[model samples]
Target chain A: MQPKRLSVLGVGLLGGSLGLAVKSVASDCRVIGYGHRRATLDAALALGAIDEGYDDPAAAVRDADLVVLCTPVSLLGEMLDRIAPFLADRAVVTDVGSTKASIVRLSEERHPGIRFVGSHPMAGSEKRGVQFAQSDLFRNAVCITTPTDATDREALEAVEGFWRGLGMRLKRCSPAEHDRLICDVSHLPHAIAAALVTMQEDAALDLVGKGFLDATRIAGGDGGLWRDIFLDNRQNLAAAIGRLRTSLDDLERLLTPESSEALRDWLDRAAERRQAALKP
Target chain B: MQPKRLSVLGVGLLGGSLGLAVKSVASDCRVIGYGHRRATLDAALALGAIDEGYDDPAAAVRDADLVVLCTPVSLLGEMLDRIAPFLADRAVVTDVGSTKASIVRLSEERHPGIRFVGSHPMAGSEKRGVQFAQSDLFRNAVCITTPTDATDREALEAVEGFWRGLGMRLKRCSPAEHDRLICDVSHLPHAIAAALVTMQEDAALDLVGKGFLDATRIAGGDGGLWRDIFLDNRQNLAAAIGRLRTSLDDLERLLTPESSEALRDWLDRAAERRQAALKP
Candidate 1:
């Protein structure tokens, strides 16, 4: 499953990190990166993240055995369509988008012949650009692969193996399930963090301690990137928000003096659950 | 303003840490700790966090020049009542309770001659008890003092100087204002974090990442302790939650295709605000 000629479209944080990580493991493998900006491509080349760089998506994937779309969630579909005609016949394509159902469905419907497996390598920070990329970015992190019935079996396995080779733990699920589950763990939390930040008064912000900062840290991510993710997975995110509101309602009900014990029990349960989820 | 004899009621994390921190700066000061649990008091003694320990609150504060009530928020008023009659004539009293208005008001009305000043040192970890106490726990952290009109000027200055001597950045405001502001920054975040953890499905919990963990870390604090704070400041917390809901509703409206640009702007604003709030 080793990609000898890997083409990474959109050489930002994830793409540049992918290039470095792949090169660290497979030094002889050639990496080609594509970015709309000449400066970004130049930066990737200067960092030795890519052997060569291109502004054209078609040129980037011309001879590559593996092609990964590393653009924003909203641009994934367009990138796939542009690279479809120029992809090598044996090329196995994938993406690093957070949401899966929309892009996975689009790929299945538009390019049925092209083998494309949806992937979300959940390893990154609030940082952007190739300058922040790390060679071990994916190491020991979870990489989820969303495979529908239309997905080619070999391509799914290849994508999973590719992530595993980069020292990632692999998880497989349907794209719809991925969207729903991830909406709860990732998207919903991001939206809530943003809302928390938005709701604060300047006086409150001035008094913020380490807890508030950590609670809202995810809200500091690039908005354009999250905007795409939120819109793409709006349905699941909306439902997740509804569930969160219900949780908040339950908490409100326990705010009374008569429910003092109940409130403590509720908080204790959440604390125990979260503690259990922590990696020992 | 240095107290020769300092009494720390409740020999838990914050109380024990306060004793150690005070001892680090002023070696001659004698620290007396009171805890219902003999084992906890013994642990504080073994850690060198206290010079003497007592099960009775009055015994703990006897002959003390300063007294810090460190019991749970619900018990703070009772602790004050018990220690009031036995306190030295010039003894200045304070508390480390998160919510200030109730206790501050109670002290002003019930124990007017006690020289009580409400303090909240924005320091501590989810980890509990004297075993986790560190001398540097309050160093460089923000210690907010909530003073009422009834608060004595000399007592307020003494409490402020005490915290500053322990290397804490001091801030002062009226008791009601302190509770309202802190509810937005601290208590609301804790409630929201607990809600976030509670709303997650078991499946999503299995896939939790670093971001989710960080966002919910405050939810791991001692539930009984938070329950007291939440209940005491329920009014402010409820208002804060309502504001957060309004912010979320605004975000929901921007989740459409037509509002794509607007959505990005909304998220960008939150991101920018959070970024600006970060420590340089």
Candidate 2:
């Protein structure tokens, strides 16, 4: 299941970190990175994130046994298309896109023979660029693999094994399920964080404390990246927002003195749930 | 304006921390604490958070030059009532309540001639009790003082000086302004975090990452404490929620391909604002 040659498309934070992480686990594996910008390729090279760099996605995957598409959600399909013709025989392809259904569907429809598995490493920071990449970025983090009936069993196992080798805990689900569940955990939170920041008065922002800062920390991520996620997963995200609004509506009803006990219960339930979900 | 004797009327996390912080700076000052539970009082005393402990709030304030009400928001007015008749003449009184308008107004009207200033020291963690008290809990944190027209100038100055002495950056405004602004930054965020946690499906909770945890960390606070804050500041919180909903509405509109650029702009604006507010 070990990848002998790994090709990472887009040498940004996640891609560059993937390169470094792969090299750390499989020292004998050759890591090749692709980026449109020469400066990014040079930075990835200097940082030892990749042993070889290519300006062309096709060139990067020419001999790679494993190809990881690390571009933004909007560019994932295009990247898949660009590398579909050049992927080596028995190559198992995957991606680190936030959303899954659209990318997975696109690969299944347009690139029939490509052994592609949709992966979401669920690891990253607000900080961007190859300079911020770390070999341990995916260590102990959840890496979800979305597989469909059309997915190859051997390719899926190889992808899962590759992520586990890089120190990730793996979870498997359908692409639709991945999008729906992740919308609640990831997309909705990002949108809410942004909305929370946008709704603040200048005076309030001045008086913000650690709580507010932490609550809005996700809003500090790159805009273009999140824009693509929100747009791609708009339906599920919109539905999650509706559910959140319903929760807030319930809270509004409990904001009265008569509902004091109910309000405490509501807050306590949330607190207990979040506490239970904390990593031990 | 350091007090010769300070009475802390709750002996909980904030109260004990205040005592420890004050003792660090004013070694000669006598610290008295009040708590219903003898065990908590003993814990506070054993930890050197207080020089003395009392079960009676009135007895706790006896002969004290300064009194800080650290009880829950719902009990603040009652604490003031019990201690109003026993306070030493010219003793400056303050509180560490999250909301200011109701408490400030109540103090101004119900306890006429009492030197009271509404203070919200923006400190403390989700962890409660005297065992979690830290001497530097308030260091570099913002302490907001809400002064009404009827507030005694000397008492306000004493309260502000007390917080500043504990190494807090100080800000002052009218009680209404304090409540309104804090509703956006503190109360609203807590409410939203709780709602975010509540709306999540159990499946989604399993996939949550650091961002989701950080965005909802404030929801892990004590439920009863937050219930009081939400009820006390319901008016402002409701308004803040309405504004947040409006922001979400804008996001919904921008979740289309036609508004893709606008969506990125919206997210970018939030990211920029959050980045600009980062502590240096």
Candidate 3:
């Protein structure tokens, strides 16, 4: 059941880190990488994240036991379309996409010859580059595998087994559910952090400290990538955004210009729940 | 003016940390502590945060050259009122209060018989209690001093020099300005972090990963304390909250569900800003 060759389709932070992590536990797993930019492929190879690099993605996936799409969310369908003919039968294709449902749907419908399993490792630093890749990045983190009606059980197990070998805990969920949960806790929080930072009226930001630094830290993340994600999971994101908006509205109502006793009460409750969640 | 004796009015996290921090730098400062509860005072002394514990307010402050109030924001003024008469005439007094204007006003109006300076150290951890107290916690953090018209130059200089010796970047501002700036950056974000965690629809949050944990980390902070802070600085917090509301509204407009491309563009801008800022 060992993968003879693993092709990392995009040699960015996620792809490079996955390759590095896989190499950490499995000494025999030979890694090959392909990226649109030659610099990234070279960088991944120089970083020792991959054993080899190829400009031609078709050639990269020609003999891989596992092929992973690690490009930006917007590039997934087209990447699948181009690689469809090159993919060997039963050579399971997977993705590290933030959104699952759309990626699963696109690969299932577009690339009939290849098996597609959707994967998302909930790990990575704020930095996004091949140079930021680390073997221990996914250590103790959860990597979700979302399989659909068209997904092969053997492919799902193989991807899950690979993730587990990388020292990650595997959690199986439906594509829609992954999108919903991640949107609620991850994607929506990023958008909210950005909006919150942009909302500050303090133009003279000389007084900012660690609290502002921590709260708005996520706001400074990649927006184009996030936008693709937000749009891809519009239904879930819209709901999450709505709930956050309502909470803001309620807080606003409590904190008018003149009176604000209620604001303290709400803050107290929010603080309590937030603290309680951290206790285990 | 070398202080022969120092009294810490509360034996909790801040009080104990202050005692320990000061004792490390000034060996002659006989640090004594007092708390309403006997257990807290005992714990502070047991942990070497103070040399001795006292039950009576007057007994704690009687002969001390410096007295510090480090209780809850709501309790500072009350504690000052109780210990005002026992303060040594030239004994410099200060309170580590988050909101400054009210505390400054209280010091000016109530503690005229003794010297009072309002100070705030921009450092804390989610951990609470005397057990969590550690010396050198304030190292390399900003410690703000808010002085009123009645503040003596020598007393201000003394406290400024004290904090500077401890490796804190000292800043001087009016109490109102201090509260406002903190609201815009520190307190406001803490409130938002708290609210966002509670507002999250992702129930059964045992699955939340590093992003959610990091993003909402401050939310799990002390609720009652935050409540007191919000109420104490109601006006400034209200303004800060207003600014956040407007920003969220703009984000909502940009994310109108009907326009997919527009949403993507907005997300693109946010991501770009985020990426640009994360560079160190």
- Candidates 2 and 3, the one with greater DockQ: 2
Where does model 3 exceed 4 Å of error?
A: A201-204, A250-280, B202-204, B256-280
Candidate 3 at B84: error in angstroms? Answer: 0.7
What tens-digit string does per-residue lDDT give for candidate 2 at A106-167?
99999979999999999999989999999999999999999999999999999999999988
What does candidate 2's lDDT look like per residue over B126-237, in tens digits?
8889999999999999999988778888888988988999999999988889989999988999999999999887888888899999999999999999999999899999
Interface RMSD of 1: 0.7
> Taking the tens digit of each residue's C-alpha lDDT, what string does model 1 give over A112-198?
989999999988888899999999999988889999878899988998999999999888888999999989989999999999888
Error of 2 at B158 (Å): 1.8
Cα lDDT tens digits, model 1, B126-245, are 889899999999988889998877889899999999999999889888888999999998999999999999988888887777889999999999999999999999999999999889
Worst 10 residues of 1 chain B by lDDT: B271-280
Model 2: residues with Cα > 4 Å off, grouped in runs: none
Q: Candidate 2 or 3, higher lDDT?
A: 2
Which of the two, 1 or 3, has more lDDT? 1
Can you give the lDDT of residue A27 in candidate 3?
76
Top candidate when judged by DockQ against the true structure: 2
lDDT of 3: 0.78
| i-RMSD of all predictions | 0.7, 0.6, 3.2
Model 2 is docked with a DockQ of: 0.89
List ranges where model 1 is wrong by over 4 Å.
Answer: none
What does candidate 3's lDDT look like per residue over A159-276, in tens digits? 9888887777788889888888888878877877777656554432455556666766676666667777777777787788778767766765665534445655676676666655
